[model samples]
Target: MLRYGILFLSILFASSFDVSAAAISAIQSDLAVLRLCNASSPVSLQAVNSVLINRDMKSSETQTQDFKCFLLCLYVEYGWMDREGGFSLHHIKLTLESSKLPEYRIKKLIYSCTATEITDPCERAFNFTECFWSHSDKETSPEAEIPEKEVSDNQNGFYYIN
Candidate 1:
């Protein structure tokens, strides 16, 4: 479309802020995907608007089934969520890496919040967005130490050498 072409060409020029170019590209990409997903999902324009404006929609009463499905469509399009409701962590990490945040913080966020007991794709999408967003607001100190735990031979998908 002409809009995307214009947006794409605009990204070639530098912006005023340090991460403005990346931020702009990310935002533009999101908008394009959102519009495409919006067409296929049973969500309303109002629902999209509300969700975009309010980060607390997961807990809000406005989080309808349509809204959840819309979110799922977004994740699927972004390659963050697959057909089996599994998250492609590599894609997620790459997506987050686009942000201005440090690598450690992004990894920490993914590690702490990605695991869930939810089986439904729509529900999982909602949960993931809420989980990721909630923790993103709380700043974790880089100097903070994580308590070490002993690893078993077959724990968390890895075995100890010894």
Candidate 2:
């Protein structure tokens, strides 16, 4: 009975590890694709606005619907979202160590920093845009700490969008 219990525990541990790794991999892959898009085009606030207007994107749905908007904006502004999306283990660590940022705030930052034209302060689309350079504060990055083994085990070739 003791042996059986130990085996069960081991299996549980392995399964947990596997799940976490897969999660990390998916995150990593998404980052990679965003990075690729950013590289393809230097993102700017104007560029994002153009895309948003063209696509009619909005800040509804808790701003998740705005992720692609943020991505395009980031690409227009900084020319890359995440330093090549975990190209190297060191790069991943650097990203991990950097200050944590709310996903929404980061998106807003990309807009403020990259906004080329700010003629209409009266009709500003989103208020959060100020957070970009309003202060130098860095929030915790989205990449939460997961076991290294788990992150590695779930390496994915492509990032998925919901």
Candidate 3:
């Protein structure tokens, strides 16, 4: 009985560690993506951190606008949004799918945040980001959710599995 109990405990601990490691790896991947997006403009992570420091603080519209623009710029830099002021839904879907995020959430976000008539890249980015921020909800944010699948390596490349 004692030996069995120890074996069960070890298995439980190992499983928990795997979950924790997967979560950490996901976070690291997210940060890496953000860094790649910010490579051109090079906004320091510290600046972004400062913006997130006081989520409850009442901020001016301009401050809000800045943050939104920053996020939009990252999306654009990532090639998820085109220079011609079009969003690549395919890319967004691919990314979210890989992350094990809900497809409905991505659809809803695109529906709510896209600027249908915008033609200029910068203006479109601004509009889209503004819309995104206005409709942003805690439950819908990718960072707020844990991935349902773990990313693993295979002969081909990386893949997610339950």
lDDT leader: 1
lDDT of 1 by residue, 1-162 (tens): 434443554465335446665777777787688767766665655555456556657444447776787788888887887644567666788888988777777777776655666878788888888788788878888865543333333422321222
**What is the per-residue lDDT of model 3 for residues 1-162, given as tens digits with 9 covering 90 to 100?**
323333454467556775677766665565566655455344444445444443322334324444445556667656567545567655666875776657667666655555356655556666665565555453565454433333343433322222
For all predicted structures, in order, the TM-scores are 0.66, 0.20, 0.46
Better of 1 and 3 by TM-score: 1
TM-score of 2: 0.20
After superposition on all CA atoms, what RMSD does each candidate show versus the true structure?
Answer: 7.2, 20.8, 14.7
Candidate topping TM-score = 1
lDDT: the better of candidates 1 and 2: 1
Residue pairs that clash (backbone atoms under 3 angstroms), model 3: none
Candidate lDDT scores, in order, read: 0.67, 0.37, 0.53
lDDT of 2 by residue, 1-162 (tens): 323333454457656775576766664554455455444543433344443334333424213424444443443233232222211223323443365755444443443343333322211222223333243255544454422121221143211111
lDDT of 3: 0.53
> Which regions of candidate 1 are displaced past 4 Å?
1-32, 58-61, 143-162
- Candidate 2: residue 76 Cα off by (Å): 18
